[model samples]
Target: MFFADNLKFLRTRKEKSQTAMAEELELKRTSLIGYEKGVQPTFGVVMKLADYFKVSIDALLRYDLSKLGKFELSQIEQGFDVDITGKKLRLLVTTTDTNGEENIEMIRHQAQAGYTQGYNDPEYIESLPKFQLPFLSRNKTYRCFQIKGDSMPPLSDGSWVTASFIQDWNTIKNGTPCVVITKEDGIVFKLVYNQIKENQEIMLVSSNRSYAPYNVSIDDLAEVWKFETYNAFEV
Candidate 1:
């Protein structure tokens, strides 16, 4: 179902003609056309397409790859298939300890810039400092980010805020405190006002009254994490 649309989108995004791409994949132009027109592909042919696109067979078939942003697409092209479902989706690259328990990666002020680009890279994620919180749920993924500036008061600057990954942006409630990772803004801690249904954007508001709220299109969003708790620094 999604495969046909996803195939057409990917091909168009690559700006390749049916004949050209078919030739590159050693597939007949007609076969490629049929595949784009909803005809089922054989497992071997599926494998070929997967290899050509640098995506997983499961993602190529099950996920709507076209709906993802460029950052997310690049991640998929690198063979990191996102497990989340829905229209707006992004991969959550994480590392596990020797016991196979998930580790919480810390993204400090120094690592914020690289995190935006390397968020989907497993190696990059694994390289970050990691630890686990006993109180946090084991089933969910968590990441700690060091907050900076006076934008958020109670949390204070240089404090570490550990948040859980939010797979569905639609589930984000209005005025919810979250860590939003965007293309334009590397990582921001804000009170999110979900406007996804009406405008395909979410309004980011600062806890401090001095800072004005701004809108960020969902297209610019790479990841969203619901605020769990923070470890405030001594003032």
Candidate 2:
């Protein structure tokens, strides 16, 4: 079986270290190292790896996917070009409260620059200020962003916008307001126009007519939070 080699190849191809991958998958680093060294994994473990890597069990265990070309591997994976688009399985790094419920971390205006750098850092996420809303449904993850500028009207600068985390971009509806986190722009509140299917891009339209609409490529998107409500007053 090519499982051992395949595991190592897939992890490295994603540019993730064994320790990071293990933590993301909730596995021990030593165990992941052993798996790469040819220790047979349980059926459950194999299934988890396959799902995380977005590969079929048959291909992961039987085929040497590392030997395949980018186009060929993309064909096997299906959907978007996973190799170049950076649209892999995104494991959201978050923090929880004492009762084990998810906490809504606030990304303050001053911390926006730092957030872009430490977005994936668990410690950084945990360090942010967090709170909960009684009205919000517990099933979905929520985040609060301190938005700036007059791009999103009615809600002025420094207003707090609480949003529900959207895992799949395909589920977003056209003209829906959202808090879009991107590689180029840290975070911005805009009306989203879905274009992922046709162009692998989304057009972000600002409510304020002064600012022009812009296109954000899928490769640049870090996170998308559906707009729930906002606090017009300063928090």
Candidate 3:
């Protein structure tokens, strides 16, 4: 099914108003209206809708659309494998302009510590809940850093967030927060948006009600990482 048709069908099956879906997706109702009216949902936005409807992108776009319901989709969306072995840590990072292909710059543990110390003297790494490195190869790079500021309160405190970097922005849906690195500031995590300008003035948004929105030019950005999860060792 076409994206719009799929969207319309899913909403009806769930018996949800466009306003309700928009609110649940954290989007303006107008945007959802546009989507149903044949406006192409951005890659990010499509993911959000798929997540809300609880279906995979393939299921949303190409699968037997008639067989799925919102509740079933929600389960599929939320179902994730917990790495009990703790060998792999899922870290989200943003993309670089490497000719449209994605690239990530590795920030080592010691370098990460430098950025962390700049924010506070908390032994951020050691204090984190310990999980075995989930791999036999010690040389494999698993941890990555995200620079944070007061913008995202309570969850992030302007410190570098360490996680494994995975480059799959297209699959990453909109309204999901990510860590973007700019030339001026090493890295900042915020919601991804499509507001682009001639000079690449991309909007860096926040989901937290207390925070305000801001714009960042492409010249300002060094990298962007889609955040997966965080490792905050209990203090």
Candidate topping lDDT: 1
Best by TM-score: 2
| Candidates arranged by TM-score, highest first | 2, 1, 3
TM-score of 1: 0.64
- Poorest 10 consecutive residues by lDDT, candidate 2: 79-88
Scored by Cα lDDT, where does model 2 land?
0.85
Residue-by-residue lDDT tens digits, candidate 3, 56-84 = 78656654444434433444446532121
Q: CA lDDT, every prediction? A: 0.86, 0.85, 0.54
Looking at model 2, residue 110 earns an lDDT score of 95
Clashing pairs in 2: none
Model 2, span 115-224: residue lDDT tens:
88787899999899998888899899998999989998888888999999888787789999999889888888999998765666789999999999999987788888
- What TM-score do all the candidates reach, one by one? 0.64, 0.65, 0.36
Comparing 1 and 2 on lDDT, the stronger one: 1
Clashing pairs in 1: none
Preferred candidate (TM-score higher): 2 or 3: 2
Which of 1 and 2 is ahead in TM-score? 2
